[model samples]
Target: MINRTVIVGRLVADPELRYTPNGIASCKFRVAVNRPFKNEGEQQADFISCVAWRKQAENLANFMKKGNLIGLEGRIQTGSYEGQDGKKIYTTDVVADSIQFLEPRNSTGSTQNTPNYQSSTNTGGMYQGSSQGQYGGNTQPNYSRVDEDPFANSKGPIEVSEDDLPFD
Candidate 1:
């Protein structure tokens, strides 16, 4: 069975970070995903609850805020618990395995109070790259130049003969 979800959306509110009694970090937040089609000339969006743990959680709470675009990859999780009124309370959320900040710090329209966190790449719930001790030190990935294209030096297109066709 496959259980995975990928979502790219804006945050509905600031992430709330908390720690367990054992000192493990966790964060919860909601994401607003707009529907592809318009509903009565107005776009609709779904508010999804998500949870992140450990370093990912800390990073999210410290760096992300309402209206910031983010990308996440994770699995859907559901559970139920007994309420104080003796009723069963059901909960569903995405347990994010990885998260990426889709926008630059200054582009999110955030105010001056937002933490000036340097974004870093995360994979498989693990922080990757130089986090400057905020998220622990990790080796950064070497990225190639974005302006250079490998196929830019291609010559003129060659003419193809009908004899080279596989199906005719």
Candidate 2:
């Protein structure tokens, strides 16, 4: 059975990062994904609860913020917990394995309802989508092979007047 899910959306707020007793990193955040179709001629959105574990969780909290567009890939997870009312509440969320930043263009900016999340590290920053889409930490990207150089022969060597180079 396929339980994997992928989604792209803006974060509703900043991610909250925490560490367990074993120092294992984790974070939880919600992304506001716009629907492909508008709702009643207005923008429709779906908020997804996502959790990142280990390094990915740390990285997300380190570099992601509210209002940023992000991509997520994970599995649907369901768990039950006892509420304060002594009732068992069942919850579902995405167990995020990979997350990519897609919008608002920063690590920390414009997050709504940001109360349940904060990073021990930098609270403000931006996240860029990686080629491998690895979560947390830095990954060396594979550069595409380019056959030609962009600046090889644009212009011949010409003696520039003192004013042309703008060194003055």
Candidate 3:
């Protein structure tokens, strides 16, 4: 049985962060994902309920806000609970395994302030601004402008050590 889901959308509202009695953090939020096709010339969106736990939950609650674009990978979870009206309430949610902020805070369609997040390597969903910082390096990565060639300074063949290769 394979169960996985990926979604890119905007948050409908601010995430609600809570803690379990044992002091574990959890966050609940909704993502509004637009349908690929328009209905009657109007865009359609689905509001999906989602939950995040541990450091992921805390980071999301602290860094993100309503209307911010985000991408997440997770799996669907379903359960039922007894309601106050003596009825069974079925609940469905996407338990987020990782989340990426698609845009910078206070800006639309901008990449500034956006953290470089690698979901595969970062299960905790915490983005540390850059890979160098995350891997315990003090040096910052240099980003060249579009008109500038990154290899312009090279005049000879680049040296590559065997250890630098991904495979032997």
The candidate that wins on lDDT is 1
lDDT of 2 by residue, 2-49 (tens): 888989777798899998786767788998887889868998888999
Query: How high is the CA lDDT of each candidate model?
Result: 0.75, 0.67, 0.74
Two-way lDDT contest, 1 vs 2, winner: 1
Please give, for residues 1-168, the per-residue lDDT of candidate 1 as tens digits: 898899988899889999978676889999999899998999999999998877778999887788888888778889899999999999999978767877776667453343333443343233334554333334336333355767678797767899999999
Q: How many steric clashes does model 1 contain? A: 0
Ranking by lDDT: 1, 3, 2
Score residue 81 of candidate 2 by CA lDDT. Answer: 97
Return the clash pairs for model 3, or none.
none
Highest TM-score against the true fold, candidate: 1
TM-scores of the models, in the order given: 0.69, 0.63, 0.68
Query: Could you give the candidate ranking by TM-score, starting with the highest?
Result: 1, 3, 2
Candidate 1 pairs with clashing backbones: none
> How many pairs collide in each candidate, listed in order?
0, 8, 0
